[model samples]
Target: MRWFWIFAVGHLLLWTAVPFFTQANGPLDNVEMLNWGHEWQWGYPKHPPLPAWAAEAATYLPGGPVWSTYLLSQVCIVGCFWAAWRLGRETLSPSLALAAVAVLEGSIYYNCTTPEFNNNIMAKACWAMFILFAYYGIARGRMVDWGAAGIFLAAAILSKYDAALLLAATLLFSSLHPRARVCWRTPGPYVLTGVSLLLTAPHLWWLVNNNFATLRYIAARSSTSPSWLSHFEHPAEFLGAQLGAVAVTLILATILLGWRWRFKTVDSSAQFTRTYLAWMVLGPLGLALAYSLITGAHLRSMWGASMFTFLGVLLFAWLEARPDPALIRRTIYASAIVGGIFAAGLGLRNMIGDSLVTAPLRVDYPGQQLASQVEEIWSQHSNKPLENLGGDWWLAANINVYHPDRPSISAEQDHDLPAWTALDAWRTEGGIIVWETATAGDNYETQIKALYPNVEILRPLEFAWTKNQQRPPLRVGMAVVPPLAPIRTAELPTPAQH
Candidate 1:
């Protein structure tokens, strides 16, 4: 327990502080989530509402620094560690349980990629909690435990629909395991089902009202390959990616157990624990791969983010190896080394990325400077606050995060407006449309003209990257849609007049 706390606290602080100081702008997903969260809707076109809600809540904390999102990501990672530790302690000795949690540090999903604070990060924590409670619910037949399990399961779903994989795994295990099947005769399983349904009702209603936009997004994203060969290629790639993701965990386990460890099953008395761990670790992964094989759907490597919380426990339980203190100490040292390497790499990237890479990274985006300039341009045309913005989601969202008014992204580059955005109100209120001038080909101009015939294209503005100033200056193109009723005496000329 002592070692676990030391590792957890160290991990939380190291990860949180590194990104907070190093990143000039929130990553794409983080800012996008913040933009969606500002609307406070039950669902978005691309995903469910929980991650956005979490990101938005983080921004409202004291000082409302951008680092709040970074902190939130660490909190989710630590929560997962805590849940894994607690679950491991149920069957393993305290030191072994601590190792189960510590070994998870090897997985980049828990550290390197977590600073983004997206649906994947939220799902990780919810996945761990749901598994922990679900285990207790079945093993102890406690109604409260069952109810907690349902709540977390609903949260997992709300975080990302991928959580349905976890739910499927739970149901499959319950139906197949003799010990778990006994719960069906009791009210515990019923309570879990009812609680999950009740809590998820609002989102389900939203999905129906919106014509299942999120599901449609998932379908569109998955059907990227139509070639028959994709059926074989996609599943193979997914499996390989999973192996790579867990490579560090395997290496650390090898160090802890040494070459003497044998591939032996646990004793009969602990068979239930071993089986449960196996199901929890493999069920979601196998189901995902099977779906890819059947439908030829392209599986994203990151989608497996929440599927490995029980991996270390499963490995140890399957080997039935007792780890001594010396082995645990060496494993902890290895974990620290892994974490330090990642942290140092990120810090170096932030400090010297300009010389290392040709293209500007997302963290180098000049969000604050861009927002300040956009706000200035908007001030020249209207007295009303910049209540709305239009154009690319990434650019608009970055500005939305830094602009004093925190304008709503009324229109996206894809031209699909969010449900919360009232087109009539946006046009009447008037706002600016912005895009990268370098990427604003003829189509962008044609689209803007078609949407707003009276739009005035502003002079392009150029700004240096936040970190890599040596890179080409970012050139931003802008256009203003005049309000229905003019607020200023000077009437801006239309594109035709120009």
Candidate 2:
């Protein structure tokens, strides 16, 4: 347990610090979440509100916004680790449980990609908590366990809709598994259902009032190929991607238990535990694949982020592998080795990616500098503090994140502004509309004219990349919609300039 705490702390600090120092800007998803968090809505156009809410809350921490986001992501990873460890301890010996949780360090989803705080990161923690409490609720028929399970279930859904797969898995297991069938007769199931609905009601109401904007987003994102071969190809690609994601886990497990098959007979209690773990591990994955096959919908590899929380427990339970002190020591050493390698690789990528890649990576964008210049231009035209930004998600979000006022966002593509942004207020106060000159297309002027016929297209501004100034400068095109109110000559200092 002491060693586990040490590893957890080391992991949290290393991941948080590496991204903080190496990257110049937050990842796209992280910046987008921060922008949405500022709005503090019940739901967003793309995802549930929990991750945005979490990102917004993290900004209040001691570290500045970008550092706080990095820290928040690592905190979620560590929390998932703790939940997995507790779940493992319920069925396996303490040392074996420790080994099981430690091996998760090999999964890339838990390490390399985790720094980009998003719905997947939040769902990972929620999924682990949901499984842990759901297990206890089903096996023990306790009201407290059922209540906790309900809360986490609601949280998981609030984090990502994919968590519905986990709920379905739980129901499937409860109906068929002999040990879990007794839960139906108890008050546990009802309590779980009631609490989950009670907690989720607000988001559900938001969905209803907004006409399920998230579902529309999901539908738009789903790539359905016209070819019949897509049914097989998409699922196969998804399966292969998942296998690659967990390849390191298999390697680490083999290092701990060796290459030999070590199956051992267990008591009925242990057998039941193994079966339960297997369902939790495979059920969600199978359902996802089945959905892909039926609909020919292109599945994203990151969508599998929460499906493997019980993987370690299932692996050990199936093998009946008991780790001696020597093997446990080896597992700890291997975990450290893997963590160090990943940390070094990520650091190097962030530090030198610009020199190697032709185009600037997302992190290399000069967001702060661009935001400062945008604010300067807005000040020249309007006296009002920058209250709203209108553009595509990436450019608009980047500027919004660094902008001192933390203005509301109005996506260019949406016909109606989000509920958080008052249309009348936005029209009266006015805002800047921005886009990358290269990507905005030739019709950008036409598009802006259609929306704001009187919009003044400012001279395009160019800024050097953060890492490689010798590369082509980032050219941003801007337009200002004149406010209905009178203008004054008050200029607010840009935070970047300070």
Candidate 3:
């Protein structure tokens, strides 16, 4: 209870006076999601549909007009802390648990989490909940415990497709454990898990119906994504991200202490805890390592592993004894690692002081910024607007995922963009075009000028996001159509990810 107050204050402090602005996915993207939820479908082209509902739901909260999805991300931050605390309680003292919570939250990676409408965050929450309840399930063996775990496991799937992997890891570890046969021998938990998986059918059906376009999209993107020469300098990238997601260092210390201290003498339950840590923490990392080497798996969402690491570490701490005193040093070190993150985050925020903003990720749509701008444009053009093909899509029937009802997004992140090609024709017919651009060199802009000698650039928006920099603001530039030469139909450049 006391920690709750502290957590409340901490949560409040992190988001205190924070202005609502475009976050990772941007307002345009979120608005489209809200629209999607209103449509109430099972899935979307890119991923599951839960995030759309979550983002749209966030928009109605206090200060939502400014942008609520980012605000809600703070909620995940707090929830992560609490979950870490509970996890730490399994291994460390209350004070250490609190410290762990703080560390987990402060880690630089966690602090800078940009809210995007995706499974990364949702999966983090589910991972934390899954661990907390799995602890309960193993300890109490209550049917409800497994039921709770089942719910989380299922929700995990909806959050990110990889969640199914987590479930597999859990089952694999459980089955391999000494009591594995007994655990499965019972029909109750199995039934609970079955029902949980059954719930994922809608999403599964959506995937199958679309001929697994989402998977193809992911594969296509991964294969082409730019790879670094060597991230060996920062294996910590994944490590820091995972620790941050859990939001507690003491918890992590605790887990570490237990594993190190009691390696020789462990009980069944202790081993079970260790297994959870192994699967949740290492499972993803192992996959990512393989992906990094073999398949170019974009492990950018590696922070999802933090959901389990924090608990695993805390579980380790709780299992250690203080008399040895060695655990104390480990606890201190862990706390320091976590605390340093918040300090660094604060320092960086102040250092930048909003001097300039940029999104490091090279993207085609300034979707979030575009949302607000498009909304304004939509309002002005209540009379006449051009149909937007959104972007290139593929064989799958793509629905418009843009937020504005006015500029419908063509469900094609992969196929031909009729909208881009038709921009000039639409303008000729008194149609207003709203194009999104990241760099100054946009093919669409070239096309507009080429097709219409008098191609009027209604709005030229320039925005850039660096890897870890403040996203540059959307600068709207309007160009008027000056009579020019006939534009050649040229192939638009492909995204590195695509």
- In the order shown, the candidates' Cα RMSDs to the true structure are 3.9, 4.6, 7.5
List the pairs of residues colliding in candidate 2. Answer: none
**Residue lDDT tens for model 3, 479-498:** 33222324345433322222
Residue 336 displacement in candidate 3 (angstroms)? 9.7
The superposed Cα distance between candidate 2 and the true structure at residue 388, in angstroms, equals 1.3
RMSD (CA, Å), candidate 2 to true, equals 4.6
Which 10 consecutive residues of model 2 have the lowest summed lDDT? 489-498
Backbone-clash count (model 2): 0
Give candidate 2 misplaced runs (Cα > 4 Å).
Answer: 379-383, 415-420, 441-456, 485-498
Per-residue lDDT for 294-338 in model 1, tens only? Answer: 989999899999999888877777775545788877776887888
TM-score of 1: 0.92
| Global lDDT of each candidate | 0.83, 0.83, 0.52
Q: Which sections of candidate 3 miss by over 4 Å?
A: 16-40, 90-93, 114-117, 224-279, 287-315, 318-407, 411-413, 416-432, 436-498
- Residue 341 in model 1: shift from native, Å? 0.9
What lDDT does candidate 3 reach at residue 493? 35
Whole-model alpha-carbon lDDT for candidate 2: 0.83
